[model samples]
Target: MDEYPFTKLVIERNLTREEFAILMERLEKLNEQYEAQKEEGLIHFSSLLIHFAGMLTEKLEPDSTINALQREGFYPSLMNEFIRIIKQNNKG
Candidate 1:
């Protein structure tokens, strides 16, 4: 496997339905997380890295992934999206 392909697949494999759901639930939050990291003075590259982090997160341990986000200071960003996604999901 090539590096990029291998990595993407490896990460995708770890994603749980809930995690994906959570991500979908909170894309705005994800975007916000992106902004916060930037505003917090995490460089642009590091800010962009949040997406990679999200992918890695989806592929790795779910709770741990969220914990890591919290540790890195992404929770607030994720809040809006979480609420949106949750409400959307509930309509069934």
Candidate 2:
């Protein structure tokens, strides 16, 4: 599938919705800790959080996606825009 490592893990592990949500929550917590501590790895954690958030969007419905992101402590505005773009592209 010419998959990158991240995509390969996502596709191959086949995590359930609940499992994925747990993973998201854990990542979010770590990201927050990095930010609060002003750790050098904050950048990497933020990037991973963003990447997982994108994957989460594809795995969830609009409302569910919003709820999931909110639960993970992300602001929803950008995600809403992303959802709109994804829907628009899918329509074409």
Candidate 3:
């Protein structure tokens, strides 16, 4: 099961519903900030995601993280969308 690094980390963390909600809220805010300033905001958002993924990776094994993320119904779609957007932006 292919998964983005950040998505795998999130799943490995096994965040509670509330935790997931909070994370989503933070991501939303980051996205809004990115929209406000495309260059700097994207840098900040990417940094945040990398940091979060690193934190989670430190807490669990890679195989476990992949398994957990695969169980999450929404993660694949979200991660795929993120990958698509990143690729699209990079192409320009």
- Report the number of the highest-TM-score candidate: 3
What's the lDDT for candidate 3?
0.50
RMSD of each: 12.6, 11.5, 7.4
Weakest 10 consecutive residues, lDDT, candidate 3?
Answer: 73-82
State the local distance difference test value for candidate 1: 0.50
lDDT tens per residue, model 1, 30-88: 57666777678764343333454555442564434444444444454453333344456
Any runs in candidate 3 off by more than 4 Å, and if so which?
4-7, 39-92
For model 2 the TM-score comes to 0.36
Clashes of 1: 4
- Candidate 2 has its poorest 10 consecutive residues by lDDT at 41-50
lDDT of 1 at 44: 37
Question: How does each model score on lDDT?
Answer: 0.50, 0.49, 0.50
Give the higher-lDDT candidate: 2 or 3.
Answer: 3
Cα lDDT for residue 69, model 3?
43
| Candidate 3 structure quality by residue, lDDT tens digits, 1-92 | 24455465666677666666765675456445545655553333455345435544244543344344435543454344345445666799
Model 1 alpha-carbon drift over 4 Å, by segment = 1-14, 35-45, 48-55, 58-92
User: Each model's TM-score?
Assistant: 0.28, 0.36, 0.38
Give the per-residue lDDT digits (tens) of candidate 2, residues 9-73. 44555767676777668656644554564455332233433554554534443445444444444
